[model samples]
Target chain A: MSVTGPAGFRAAGVAAGLKASGAPDVALVVNDGPSHAAAAVFTANRVQAAPVLWSRQVVSDGRVDAVVLNCGGANACTGPGGFQDTHATAEHVAGLLGVSATDVAVCSTGLIGERLPMGELLAGASAAATALDAEGGPDAATAIMTTDTVSKQSLVEGDGWSVGGMAKGAGMLAPGLATMLVVLTTDAEVGPEELDSALRGATRVTFDRVDSDGCMSTNDTVLLLASGASGARPDPVAFDDVVRAVCADLAGQLLDDAEGASKTIEVEVVHAATEDDAVEAARAVTRSNLFKCAVHGEDPNWGRVLAAVGTTGAAFAPQDLAVAINGVWVCRDGGVGEDRAEVDMSGRAVTVTVDLGAGTEHATVWTNDLTADYVHENSAYST
Target chain B: MSVTGPAGFRAAGVAAGLKASGAPDVALVVNDGPSHAAAAVFTANRVQAAPVLWSRQVVSDGRVDAVVLNCGGANACTGPGGFQDTHATAEHVAGLLGVSATDVAVCSTGLIGERLPMGELLAGASAAATALDAEGGPDAATAIMTTDTVSKQSLVEGDGWSVGGMAKGAGMLAPGLATMLVVLTTDAEVGPEELDSALRGATRVTFDRVDSDGCMSTNDTVLLLASGASGARPDPVAFDDVVRAVCADLAGQLLDDAEGASKTIEVEVVHAATEDDAVEAARAVTRSNLFKCAVHGEDPNWGRVLAAVGTTGAAFAPQDLAVAINGVWVCRDGGVGEDRAEVDMSGRAVTVTVDLGAGTEHATVWTNDLTADYVHENSAYST
Candidate 1:
């Protein structure tokens, strides 16, 4: 179940001929709602795509009837023409779905600095609208796949209510929302303000902590649509929990399928003076090319981890820092501890824990290993 | 001619048997001074190596009679024992040279988180001091090589004096003085204050701008020893120019031999509102893995350049940014410009220029391509 797993929602994915492989490259998710409440987040990058610029305004009113997404061109750095193409595409989708053009959200992802084929995108939007169904969630998920080897979907059921979402990301993935496209839907009696608060809370902890390759994209978008068909108005705390769960699930999937990654790394920073310190420390480790390469090589090179941790401005005494790889305490008090040979990196999942010996706060960031394949894939798709 | 090319200095490189390969791993450069004025810079990384801690103090008094360098181990993250080892090495050299222990600078390279074999290092230091000669500069340069494919040395003859130096860096190279060990000696009669000011000014532009893999090493050090043997003190301005040129030469050598680098990338960002913004913009492009990979593939993918440039908070209009590859304008006004095929990247040197159209300030950062061999070398050496 993708976005359509939630009641009063329909979705579809179709071949827009935007992709040279003739694969499905256009997706639509619409809400037939008693409450047209929504919230969205876009890439934090200073360089944004035309679709991001258009959808930012679409989400400003906290209402979205439909979202049109594609995986052909980023429509970035195309000057005024790219913006016009995005506006035209939104209007076309809005007309087909009988909704206000201003209420349509758009997201496009692929190569940067290239304008989309407007004619094909409009045609694909029309076909995607025609194929919309309550069970078309999977198809919609499939259409958004770029370098992704698999489609991502997550759903959570509450008492007479449910939440669902679908995400696509494979490269240019980093925190501040990994170069991802996501659409979350919920069927509960929630107001625009409630949905917005829950979305911001959920994504802050989930999407904001997944750094796949340390590259931020120009077209990352995460939109949440609420269709109050379930009549069950969950408490704010409970609603946030469900949204966060779905987001975490989708984020995990994104990390699992991160382009050219051989291992999924979970960096946990503990005993930090503050949560921010923990996050800062963890992000530095995730960004270290040396550490990532060691992870790919299945070597418990905790020295690299310590070196990376030292680079952060987090409050920690070098002599008091400790690191553990897989489950083995490899470095204690910033010096060698357990035998590195004892650590087992035989699995695809790896966990690194750094204890600051400063205080109690902690945080975790998920990332991927750097490998030769990462270079190969990036070299092939750099354009 | 390396450090010893200057008058009143002697140098030597000898096998301390500290390296597993039994190669010459210990080097000593002593200033038999008429004037013992000296200056030095260490890695900006918070997690400094043991030798860096020792040498930083050694130069704090503005007088250094000798420098002891080794390439067998970094002696970092070894806790108190590592610091003690560095101290012992300095003391050994000081006793042999009949100078105070506080006047002997120390430098170490190789793997971190390991302790030096104190006995072997002391023995090597003894042998190195015994082998010190006026023409031993090349041998001292050879001793500092780790994974470096070749030794790097530069010499500049001024009005009545000369400046000579050597450097070694292959990986973990980045600004904040790049991961390298350097030693420079001059016959010019300059005070410690002048030497310090000139050294800082020179390194800030050269060594501090070469970011090979964005990894700041814990063992980076640059030392300048001055002797008044030539009785020639050129104008301070002229002295700084020669020092900067020597540093720029050594920095370029570090980038050229960056571990497994197939291309040396020069990223110049111009028309920024401030010099800091220019440096930030240029460094951001240098750190872009996608852009580096594109350079490796010999693809003039200026879209990656724009994407990388957009990530920086430097003052620039998205529509006014222009990028040129190899002097070919592949992107102008942020729109596709000039055929990408017109940009020839067949050579190893690549130049990517970005015009921000914000002001007149500019900065240049040198980096290397992200190649499979880079991954291989880093992975193999990570532990």
Candidate 2:
């Protein structure tokens, strides 16, 4: 089972002592291809990780040949020493692969403000380089796991081209543009400009819409590396579509795997006067703890839904609003309408619809129901 | 014991059937005045309650002789009918007290979007009026309790001038000007202009610093009515000083009664580049769930404290930051310093200090730690 999305890429995953559990803590993916064109998105949080800083600087030239990722310690808030460690890690990877240090991007996620174990990390990198193979993509995906229960990997094959990607995150996932650590590989011939545009467009609606908890991470990074090995350059428009499809699929996986989550909720805000209003209302519902808890309990509490909507800055008369949960019209014209007891929630997917009765503009956001496990998991960790 | 602090105001509290548990739910305070001058502040949430709307309108003329308060059914999101109920409640109070309708202010809290129980509410209002006496302030304070373990009342008396206030709220309390509902009566002779100025100044630093939870309420209101009954007029500066002290004391009481609150955490952000930066840093700490939980468990997790500060918009070099928990400096110059085990948290008050290393600006915010009870209580009810 080759983890590489394209024909000309090799991948490796290995256990590093950085993780206390001795799980595969390091993953390496390299482009053995016709082009090194790449584009990446980093966390918008002002308090960024050392890897984020290094990767951001590496990708500024629109070229990247490989990416190195490790789990167990997010080298964030470690001050100057952390930044030095990130630079050294990239340099070591570049030296082993015979590539320029600037072409090597790095990513990490785990505990914040913890220093990387340099000896174990370097040893893991060396082993990863020797273990890289064309058929090791699956193992590489599994290596990046932190608290994730399952590996998130998706491959979309088009005519003479393919897009492959992997994602890892269980909490602190709020979509500002990207929410988790993801690496996308493709053999499709595309330029950096096209890749940037496609990634932004895809992430805007997909990864950016899934808000597991409202906390933003300091180490989130999403990088798309094009090997361009197939020499079958598809139309830019078509290539963008494939990129979006891959992102959407991976985003669904992240939401489904949200920590302590029982259901993946889709909140659709339609008939708004403007797209901003639609997005605001959708995001408000997605971030509401009470609304999320009600969903977890399988309770159709439409009154709480209306209250969340009312708190948004969007202008909508309470009387003009309507809401539906799980396809049942539970509220209409701002008051209770249908019998809420009729709605079922035996499945893992739930849908909430809001009709603003303004215009045709619409937006949808993905979220998970709040559960006791969420509180338990978060509160148990002193840090 | 007379609840009036050198003032000649009659107050009373009585049980109304508004609460499901049949507890005392109504309170009235009337200033028997030689001069009736008042100022009021209300919630900034776009979605306003009926009482909030009515009070805002009534206080526009700057004269109010009495205040009517009830807990258990917050007439919010009840649409037009709710607005009518608020008007009727005020009108009834005014009619019974032989005061002008425009001279009365009303406030309600508890479940949102519910209609007032007119029959029980009216009967309770009549009873409260008949029971009103200058020494019934403590009873009035107890009447507005809803899930609160204790009644919050504060009094300040000096040189024949006095200020007395009562407050109610345990959750959904975050500061804009006021989080919960508050009523203040003063015997000092001050015009409406001076009263408004003093109230705003006092609340800016006192009630505005308490953040029990990040949830903003739709029915929060604070009204100050001056009766000039003591026949002693203090200067504007002296009156403002007394008002500030009273507000601070009342704010302390509110924080002590916060829902599921084990300890009151005061976050101080010092040496910020600007006032906004200081405030933003303080708010970031106040809103951090992880930090709150750490404090609850009596763990001095300074790393989480820095992480919380890093999320703020304030500009600062990580290497220039310092943090202290309960007077024990745990991190200095952005690196871990003293052992976190040295900090003691056996008391009910915990303090966190952050030095932004930007300038001399500073700010303080009061918040409660996150406990299992908070999750239990909030998850058990619908907004």
Off-target runs (Cα >4 Å) in candidate 1 are none
DockQ for each model: 0.69, 0.34
Model 2 chain B: lowest-lDDT 10 consecutive positions: B1-10
Best by lDDT: 1
Off by over 4 Å in 2: A1-3, A177-179, A293-312, A317-323, A327-348, A354-358, B1-3, B177-179
* Model 1 whole-model lDDT (C-alpha atoms): 0.90
lDDT of 2: 0.83
Candidate 1 local lDDT, B338-361, one digit each (tens): 888899998989999999999999
Model 1, residue pairs in steric clash: none
Please provide, for model 2 over B258-318, each residue's C-alpha lDDT reduced to its tens digit, 9 standing for 90 to 100. Answer: 8777989999999999988988889878876667777887878776677667767897887
Q: Give all candidates' CA lDDT scores.
A: 0.90, 0.83
Interface RMSD values, listed in order for every candidate: 1.5, 3.0
